[model samples]
Target: MAVSCVRADPRLVEFNDIKIGHVYKKTVTLFQFTAASPAMVVVPGLLIPEKQEEVRDCLLIHVEDTETIKIPLLEFPKVCSLLVDSVLDFGCIAANNQVISKHHPITNKGTAPGAFQVQYSRDPLVTVSPCVESLQLAPPSG
Candidate 1:
């Protein structure tokens, strides 16, 4: 004997394909629905339209509970590269050290150019050149 899977009730599960680099949202209004054993809705891997085989961390879904759970699928592209460190630190400088400075770069590892703003605390001891400002990064092609 072979076990045949049945289609989910249309009234229960509903989903639509989303586009990359865009946002998709749905509002589900339920009336007096009881879920004895709430089931977790897990979305495995979201397909990338451009490169179907390539898998990237782009979509995220959050389900609160069983009955009143609101499933909103968020889709976003790799607009900004991943920054391992947000704060750049300069090691303690010697009292006699003439010049104490550090060069930190905000790299854009994403497919598109990443926009960033630099901000730092006001400290008389430390000097930050190129005051906190907005800047854009060219997309890397290597």
Candidate 2:
């Protein structure tokens, strides 16, 4: 006798279906750089729990790389908490596979730049063009 099994790929899993406040582990990198050159590897042994607490480490690095260096990343359900300048309502969008475009701006009201990722949307019809964005603002000149 022969038997076969099928398993769903975790990589293909839709994280949006997860309930709020679910704890999960994700690997992140932190870099130590100089004004002259970039480093080969980021600082290691830095671990933090995915809770709603501010992790203050470096201000300069944050200003340089907003897509990185943020503490306690607001991924998963927390991503939904992102504050948009205004709500987007695409009522009765074109059908028959016709694409429509809407432009919006995201603000970073911090001393450092940050990253925002559009993992998934509640509406199947809604999608982001450049799924990920870096929220970088100019650093204070000394």
Best by lDDT: 2
Model 2: per-residue Cα lDDT over 51-136, one tens digit each = 54433332222333333332432322322223475766666765777777877766664544567877775888777767887866
lDDT (tens digit, per residue) of candidate 1 on 13-37: 2223334544333333333323343
What TM-score does candidate 1 get on C-alpha atoms? Answer: 0.38
Model 1 ranges off by over 4 Å: 1-3, 6-74, 82-87, 95-97, 132-142
The count of backbone overlaps in candidate 2 is 1
After superposition, the stretches of candidate 2 with alpha carbons farther than 4 Å from their true spots are 1-83, 121-125, 138-142
What CA RMSD would you report for each candidate? Answer: 11.8, 22.4
Q: Which candidate should be chosen as best, given TM-score against the real structure?
A: 1
